[model samples]
Target chain A: MLEFILARGNYWVIVALMMTGLYISFSAQNLIKRLVGLSVFQTSVFLFYITLGKVAGGTAPILIGEDLAGHHGAGHEEDAAHGTAAAGHEAPVETPAAPHVETEPVVEVDPETGEPIADPTAIDPAAELAPDAVDPGHSDIPPLQGEDASLMGEPLEDGVTETSDYVLSGHDGAADALHQAAESSLHSVYSNPLPHVLILTAIVVGVATLAVGLALIVRIREAYGTIEADEVRNIDIDVALEEEEAEDAAAEGAA
Target chain B: MNPDHHVILRVVAKTLIPLITLYAFYVQFHGDYSPGGGFQAGVIFAVGIILYALIFGVSSALRLIPPSFTRGLAAAGVLLYAGVGIWALFGGGNYLEYGALLDEPEGGHHGQHIGIILIELGVLFGVAGSMLTIFYAFAGRVAEISDEDW
Candidate 1:
């Protein structure tokens, strides 16, 4: 029980919100307050679905590029090729720098020797040092580059990338995940797109329902002179009783 | 209603309204690459207009966008959405196949891009129109309810 509670705390909070919204919508006297409650309930449901779709370290559903590796392959190859070409010379590469090229850019081509210089500022001290101690250049290199590169490529989260298939084919495990994520750092993602697509339609439908409900409430207020449910019910009951009495009188008079 | 003046609010609103609309368009167009698309953008767009209505008075807002136009827009938006699907059908593909939007089904992602944009545009119109219409309906009733009724 403790393990379950600890693992799924967000679910508990969502339930609480859902219950509060349901209670308010069902029990509130004022029509507008009820609508507000309904809105709250709708919002909570949205949150629930969003939360469900979230992975431990996932990006949004948007596909930055279809062939994630190839997208950055061209850039990396160009940089490497430029570095090799300029090995004998001392001139900066003329490629339009990646949009995400940071201020203290990492793995930058050195201006003096025109060699790739990994910036110390961009590297995490812990990740860099820890890996070097166990295996100097093999295992630690990729993960460290992954971590730094992921952070460097966050600007593409806004938009303006090539379109491709949204669903990424599953890879093996942590290393593959890290590699894929690091390679296409711009489109780093772990979240499912299915939920986002489903919710897109639901949101519009939800708004339509809210609009119709509001319209009904307005009409009700105009007819009964009150939006309170109890008041409206009482008026309806009185009208029913008056009709019954009039019908009975008419029957007696005809007899 | 009492005539009031708040220079700060008016100035701030003036600045924010254009920014909000701009952001909404950004979200709409950039949605394929980001987390937002038509629904979210439309709501944000409607919110911008709604803010204008609240600040400048419903009468002025309604004058800016008549209720009749909103009704027409709502229907037109649905038609636009359906039209895309019908167009696809005529193109010899399943309804809303999207790949059919392009002349060459084997071409590339351009057809899908076109299809998504059309649907999103439809959604933008539908959502924006209905939201504004609903706001108008609610605000229109204010005159009928006297101050004492509250």
Candidate 2:
């Protein structure tokens, strides 16, 4: 229970925000407060969309050149060959002054086993459960891939240092993942750009709708001399009562 | 004391508005590769103008961009979006079939590259103009920029 709950912390935060926004919109009597609630709800949706697009160790949807090693000369050549035109962005942040050594992505294939050379413990978890990723019986769950080809720990509460280890080994993992993809694509990802685009469009549309709602509120305030919903209701009731009384008086006079 | 003029606000707004506009354009153009795009850029642009209005008063802002112009801006944006689709049609494909927009048989997604930017432009105009138009309706009081004596 602890493993499941703590590992998936993001869902808890999203739920908290969603409930708060829902409560505010439903309970608020002030017109502005209700709008605020609506905005909060909209924000939750944005968060949800963004969360849906996030991959554990993925870059943005923008395709980097084929060389995950980011070997400056190598990536440049790859960019040219691929015709993707992404030039300056291929290297990691640490490599502004790094030497221009031309190197291919070096995944050491074992002389006998044909398995990739990597830390045994790092590969242990996924190696043990590798069949789960491919098995028909376990197909109901979305395939929880290792961050690379390894480090597929269940992310229980017991480990904090694993994250750092993963970071230190991330680039190696990327290259290895790409290399291994020729046989199997156990883990490699890019965040979905479709949702990114949708959110970009949605944010503007959200604001425009908010503005329309506020404009309506402004007009309401101008016409009714108050922005409170209950106050407006009172004014409406008073007008209806007066009209009814006037109609009754006119009927009596005709009789 | 000249309560009629907000010196600090005016100065601050004067300095910030230009930078905000510049950043908005940067975001607009860099949309494909970066985190920002047309919607965000449009909001930033609108925010710059809105900030100006809040500080210098709505009248000055209206003077800068008349309500008629803003209305036209909104309509023009919608038209631009449709216009791109029509242009694609002229290129001998269905609506918004961006691959047809360019004749480069060997060029990879050249049409998509241009089409996406143009659509982003349309979104920018549509969002910003509608935002300002709504603002004008509220702040200007019955769609009038300057209020006269009853």
Candidate 3:
């Protein structure tokens, strides 16, 4: 319920800004005052974008070294355990002295041995040719696998595939996660474009309005030697009365 | 305006504007990890300037930031924002796809941060200057008319 209220709060703020802008544009005689109102309205939208990007319990997606290491360790452990268990036998313990086997292709020669260091984990040979890949000239030594797991005494589960938790959540958790993911993705995609387009449109409209308002101010200055809104309105009223009298006299003369 | 009035208002404006602008920078820089961001901070900073203009007379504010400079700043901000999109395009990605800014697509977060900061700066200038400009335009007209009557 709290989340719902927070989510809708932005919409309410936008509505309020809209109403304020409308009121100021229609009722405020001062041209600059109207621009202020328009800006207030535009700002409310910026607020909306900032609010939408917020993720619950998610840190800024910035990956720190610790975070990267944690993820790498978890993934490596999971893969090694699963692979060994699927083989139906205890995997041979890897020793530090054993030279690592290369599983991937090498594109460069080692400076020391003048031999190409194979990339043990290169999934693609074409990727090996990429300039940014780790220099193939280094010793193609693969890290000892299962050594860490052996130290921990945790038998790595071989191919212990758990059923999708989505099915176990009895539909609610799965649905919620999916909904949240979709919303976040949508927000990410639209957050950039929406504000840019809206602000641009507001600016053009603002400029046009400002131009017209300035022109009116100029005209008011010429007619009454004053550009003040109050003075212009008073002068306009007097002129209307004179025109009305002139029109009445012309009609009487026609009669 | 009285000297005292000028002093008081200037003190207030200086105090508030810097604090608000600092907060804006904080939000813009930390946006990747927080609830605050460029757009929100920009508006707040603009409001702070508007408040300054309101407290001090329009003429005083104009002296601090001329109308022509404000207009130029506003335009420059928009140009900077569009330039980021253009940069992304040149970097071999779709428009605004900051990932393409560098050779490693995964390192695109850095590019995104740069793009966001540039866009936020644009928003800050445009909002603050235009708001101040509007205040000046109305206040000038009103002052001129009132003086004529006197």
Q: What TM-score fits each model?
A: 0.63, 0.63, 0.43
List, for all models, the DockQ compared with the true complex: 0.08, 0.13, 0.08
Per-residue lDDT of A1-255 in model 3, one digit per residue for the tens?
A: 333333244466777887887788667766557666766665666655454433222222233333223211112223333332111111121111111212211112221111212333532322333242322212122221343212122322222101101011112344554565456435332222234545656665756566566656555655677545677788889999999999999999999
Q: Model 1, residue A91: displacement in angstroms?
A: 40
Estimate, for each residue in B1-150, the C-alpha lDDT of model 3 and write its tens digit: 766667766887778888977887787667545665655665666676667667776677678778888788767777877787888788876576555555343323566556666667676666656655665566555433444453
If ranked by TM-score, best first, what sequence of candidates would result?
A: 2, 1, 3
> Per-residue lDDT for A4-27 in model 1, tens only?
233344566778888888999999
Q: What is the Cα-based lDDT of residue B24 in candidate 2?
A: 90
**Candidate 2 regions off by >4 Å?**
A57-190, A249-255, B1-9, B106-109, B142-150
How does each model score on lDDT? 0.59, 0.58, 0.49
- Residues B26-139 of candidate 1: C-alpha lDDT, one tens digit per residue: 999987556788777878999998998888888888898899988777778888989999987886666875656665634355666788788888878887888888888788
Model 1 native-contact share? 0.14
Candidate 2 lDDT over A113-136, as tens digits, reads 111122233333323322332221
The ten-residue window of minimal lDDT in model 2 chain A covers: A107-116
Q: Pick the candidate with the highest TM-score.
A: 2
Chain B TM (all candidates) = 0.90, 0.87, 0.77
Give lDDT: candidate 3, residue A172: 30
Predictions: Cα RMSD each: 15.6, 12.6, 17.9
Candidate 3 falls in which docking quality class? incorrect
Clash pairs (backbone) in predicted model 3: A85-A158
